[model samples]
Target: MFIQNALPQKPNLWKYIIGLIVVVFFWRGLGSIPLIAAMFTKASDLGSIDMTPAGLADLLGANLFLSVMLSSFVLGLIGLFLYVKFVHKQSIRSLTTSREKIDWGRIFFSFFVTILFIGGFLYAGVMMEPDSYQWNFNKEAFIILAAIVLLMLPLQTSFEEYFFRGYLLQGLGVATNSRFWSLVITSSLFGLMHIFNPEIQKIGYAVLTVYIGLGFLMGIMTLMDEGLELALGFHAANNMTIALMVTTDWSALQTDALYVSSAEPDLGGMLLFLGGMFVVLLGIFALRYRWKNWGNKLFGKALVLEEETTA
Candidate 1:
């Protein structure tokens, strides 16, 4: 039913291709200008800029740089909503869920659920390896970071969910008429999108499994839940918690978080831990939602209902 929402629009492959191009133009092309300009100005003042996360944080100051970085997604989201409305003749509600209204309840539930897990795990990690973490909290910096995280980071994560799970998922499912392939392609692209993350350089290519695994987990959640609310909440919480709770040199975004990790990431153990957590979350969601019809919902063909076309 979620993917079928696209059916009434008579989804053409070209529309999706062109739509993506437009969104990316706003997101990456025009959106990057401010950040680039800021970096250039900073470099000119400083005589050289490092360009690494830490370097940029130092150059532009963490909160300002983070704001500029996330501003891109804001523009991209605007571009996407415009295209979906005018070009595709689809409502934002339809892009979000089959439900009559966007479910804020589900979003908050998922958000708090993820926050609990992240907080719990972080506490455990700090206790188990006291030497790995240092108190890095600065009251003024943290207050600023909190404001940015609360306001701007959601836009970034929302953009990703709307693009990957909402737009591309529906588009691909309609194009291939196969839910399975749609999940696979979108999840893979989501993973590939993170290939250049600083974590890869720090933790090695094996870390990609974690990213890909996250993509699959989010994709499965989207398909099973038939909405982006859960995925959106989960994604936002995951990033927000990380941004608020911790920072490390090799991290993609280095901020004045509460703690800084000095320990080298254990890729193998992290993979297993995260993989297990994914399963547990899935089980919880499955039980709570009472998800049924796995065969049809996940792997079955996506058909355009005649009623949808007529309506």
Candidate 2:
């Protein structure tokens, strides 16, 4: 049904291809402006600075780097809306959900569930190892970080959902005519997008398995829920809450958060943690959503008239 939203219009396959390129170009080109400006503001000798996560954070200051980094994603989000509206000639609602109204409940529920599950333990760890966390809180600076996060993370995560889960997933599904391949392609691409992130570089490429795997789970969630609500909310809550709650030397965006992890990456431990959490998360989501017929939903044909199929 979600994929069928692209069908009524019978969009040319090239439209999806060209649109993706245009959007990404604008996203990268515009997003790079801040980083470029930082070369001037953050450097006396730009050539000497390493471009890694900690390196950038050190040069730009944690708060300013995060603010600038997230600022680029804002333009990327706008690019998606513009391309979807004019190029695809699709309404934002159509891009978002099949319901007459977008389901805020699903979004909020996913948000709460994911935060409680992930953040709860992260906070517990900070408490348990009081030495691992140094309170980096500053009243004036934290107020600024909170404001930047509130404004930017939603835009960043929402754009990711709209692009990966909503746009590419549906477009590829229609083109390939198989839900499995669509999921595979989009999920892999989602992982690849983060190929340049500091986490992957820090933890080694094995971490991509986690990224790709999470992409698959999120894609499955999108298909199962018949919308982007759960996926969008979960992503937003994960990034926003994490940025507010902690800063780690290895994280993508190092911010002035309340706690910072001093632990080095233990690949086995990291993988185990991700794999374990993923299983529990899927189990919980499955029960909450009452998901059924995995064989049909994931591997079956794309529905023709979503209403007939869903009904």
CA RMSD of all predictions: 2.4, 2.1
Q: Name the runs in model 2 displaced over 4 angstroms.
A: 305-311
TM-score of 1: 0.95
lDDT of 2 at 148: 83
| Residue-wise C-alpha lDDT for candidate 1, range 1-311, written one tens digit per residue | 78988988898889998999999999999899888888877676545667777888888998888999999999999999999999999999999987889999989988998989887898888899989999988999999999999999999999999999999999998889998899999988998888888888888887878877888898888888888999999999999999999888998878889999999989988888788778878888898889998887788876656785599
TM-scores for every predicted model = 0.95, 0.92
Estimate candidate 1's alpha-carbon lDDT, on a 0 to 1 scale.
Answer: 0.89
Most TM-score-accurate candidate: 1
Candidate 2 clashes between residue pairs 3 or more apart in a chain or in different chains: none
Which ten contiguous residues of candidate 1 have the minimum total lDDT? 42-51
lDDT of each: 0.89, 0.83
- Candidate 2's displacement at residue 10, Å, is 0.9
Q: Hey, what RMSD does candidate 2 come out at?
A: 2.1
| Per-residue accuracy of model 2 over 59-153 as CA lDDT, tens digit each | 88877888788877788888888988898898888888878778899899988888887798778878888887888888887888899888888
